[model samples]
Target: MYKKSLVFLFLVFTVCHGDIFEECEDVESESFVSSWQSCQSYVYCDGDESMLGECDEGQYFDPETSSCDDAANVKCFLDEVDEPSVEEEPEPEPTPPVMEQPTDVEIVNTAPVVKPNCPNSDDPSQVIFMANNASCADYYLCYHGHAIEMHCTNQLHFNGLTGQCDYPENVHCPLDEPSAHKCLPHITDFFPHPDKCSYFYYCIKGFLTLQQCPFYYGWDIERRSCVQLNVAKCYGNSRRA
Candidate 1:
């Protein structure tokens, strides 16, 4: 009788911890759960909108009107928008504002006249004459109704009907003439005598004319240094005899 009792206890313990309890048992072919637990281990649900035509769960299988919005984690069902049978509203026309005429001011008509004041004689109070040996013969006639100073140094070819020197062709200066010209502006009262004009530079010294101080190594007045002019290498260097 004791042996029978021991066999009964062993059989009961084995039955309690059976292999069938530990194994996963599928509730349906599509979903499954552990046989040992009441709650399902995994559940297969229909796809939402994003994965159209796909069989994967949480993805949209229907493409017709559904869109899977993972951000909202919901399937967006769009309604088919039928074409409207009625005409749409016409856009409003913009209105132009009425402007009022201004009062009290009379617009005066004036003619544009080009007065060829002698070249370099801009101030009305001052009297200026053409340099005795001015390279251009006719003096500077305002071309294009604007005054620009040009010189004729070489020959008749250098002097055009405009009374201005033509820029030399096929020649290049070490530094450009424009940049050099910018260094000096308004050479007022620069009255070097005809004989000295070729060889000397005149500077206006507080309304009195004075010769440019010889600058062998440095700029005068400013005490800034510069190199001696190589007359042979550079044209326009002073032919100071």
Candidate 2:
């Protein structure tokens, strides 16, 4: 009975080994052995029950083909190295234009000179004076806010007396030209002069002569002589009639 029991145990172990690992004998090289068991050396499951098997070395289980392969061949990730990661590249923005500064010194411009008023007073435009007096011939013109004197041509002198331009010869004694010029004493008209008692000009023959009345006397034009203004005469004139 003991001898029979030993035989039985040997047969059981042999059968379990055979059932767990398929014989790698006909597998010509290490490649076939690894492929057959996926490099599992100790544990292997064939159908249902697990048993022991052997692999050459340095290899792991490959689930896909259900076999053992080389360390280089077995992979949990087969396409890991083969598949490249796809990444998006961003587009570059457009560059702005550059402005260049001038190196040379910039020239600053000066404002132009301007004249303040009208070009000339001689223009056809007429202007009046302080007295509201205006005439093309005798008037006042303004140049830069100043009055420019104007006059009429040839033989015409402004008659301040009559407010007209008359001959100088025509404008005679007792000059009615106006105020300070009025009541002019002349060679022809013997009039009383406030300055001397009297003073006069007389045209004798072709010669002109100056004559003065006595200190206390004045010239009387109607009498044509120097007479006493009061009751006195400084002297008697033979020329006086």
Scored by lDDT, the top model is 2
| Candidate 1 lDDT, 16-129, residue by residue in tens | 222232222323332222111111111222222111011222322122222222223332232122322333255564343343355764543432222335453233333233
Model 2: colliding residue pairs = 34-68, 38-67, 38-68, 39-68, 161-177, 174-184
Candidate 1 clash pair list? 48-59, 48-60, 49-60, 49-68, 50-68, 51-60
Off by over 4 Å in 1: 1-144, 153-188, 193-212, 217-241
How much RMSD separates candidate 1 from the native structure? 38.2
Clashes of each: 6, 6
Q: What is the C-alpha RMSD of each candidate to the true structure, in Å?
A: 38.2, 65.2
Q: Model 2 reaches what TM-score against the true structure?
A: 0.17
